[model samples]
Target: MPHIKQILCIEDDLFIGEMYRRSLTKAGFAVDLIASGDEGLKAATNKQYDLILLDVMLPEKKGTEILHALRGEGKDLVPNSRILVLTNYDQDDESKMAMQSKADGYLIKADITPRRLLEIIYSLDVQSTGAE
Candidate 1:
């Protein structure tokens, strides 16, 4: 419901992160791009974000592990953030795990463009606010 002004993108690929950062920032959202899963978890826990765009694989931790942690032990810490799993991996088990962990949405990076991602975020905002 609250305007989605802040977003955290936990992506390992620098190029993709930059692309998202540029697009999101240009669209008037403040975006934090973290390249590793460990740091991503730390940021997600320590700070509040309107939305979290999480990748599945990373150097220190997997996104699924982060989802479990957030939805499990750290649930109270990030109560309002909408977490969207954004990964190129199409593995069924991982997607199932993320959904079981209560991820708001799951997306494949290769299938999404920056513009389309922004549209999805806008739709999420609309859904939250119950606005058309």
Candidate 2:
């Protein structure tokens, strides 16, 4: 049986966040949507989730900054929880930084559909399981 996943979606845009939440929820994943970077960072550090959908440009803190902090010693993020950067940005400096900071993947939001996003998450599940 496929394991049910819990996902944390950190997006400042209301429309995008809700869309992801609704789609992911319908796809059989438990989704937690956090609108602000600060709240997202707090939730990420305090809880263990199966996957994280992170946005780059956010209020209070940038997603790269949050990824850096989580990958560092200060915050305790789940080691197995896949973290994917979901933003409009492409392979720019910010995306490079996120990759260097241990982001599992970086994807342009405009280029992906919700169904494809779910597929990527499932692929991450395979990669994560193999890594352990």
Candidate 3:
């Protein structure tokens, strides 16, 4: 059986963060829900996660900036951690920036069903295990 170690979710919206936390946890994943991108970046730098769910707009820092900073720092948050952008922004300049920052997957919050999010999380966990 596969176990979920950790998931860092950087979303400012309280409702969304709580929802994802509850949903992912119900799917057998340990989730750390954060509200600020800066805080998320700091937490990520200090700890290792199985996956990351980031929102585009955040107070103090933007998702793209955090993602790019992590990539530049070679934080190994990619392929390993699997950064997934879960934001309201989809197919716009912000989304483009996220892609440029090396987001593994970009998901629109509105389009995300609970089941779909679980699928994405499972896929990430599977990929991580395969890589190891």
As a whole number from 0 to 100, the lDDT of residue 33 in candidate 1 is: 96
**Ranked candidates, highest TM-score first:** 1, 2, 3
Q: Quantify all predictions' global Cα lDDT against the true fold.
A: 0.88, 0.83, 0.79
At residue 51, candidate 2 shows an lDDT of: 83
Candidate 1: 10-residue stretch with minimal lDDT: 94-103
TM-scores of all candidate predictions against the true structure: 0.90, 0.86, 0.83
Q: Write the per-residue lDDT of candidate 1 for residues 13-63, one digit (tens) a residue.
A: 999999999999999999999999899999999888999998988889998
The lDDT, on a scale of 0 to 1, for candidate 1 is: 0.88
Residue pair clashes in candidate 3:
none
1-132 per-residue lDDT for model 3 (tens digits): 133568899999999899989988887778998999889999887787867888888899998788887775555444446778877765578658646568778788899787898887777667757766
Candidates sorted on lDDT, descending: 1, 2, 3
Best by lDDT: 1
Error of model 2, residue 82, in angstroms:
0.9
Candidate 2: minimum summed lDDT over ten consecutive residues — where? 72-81
Give candidate 2's error at residue 128 in angstroms.
2.1
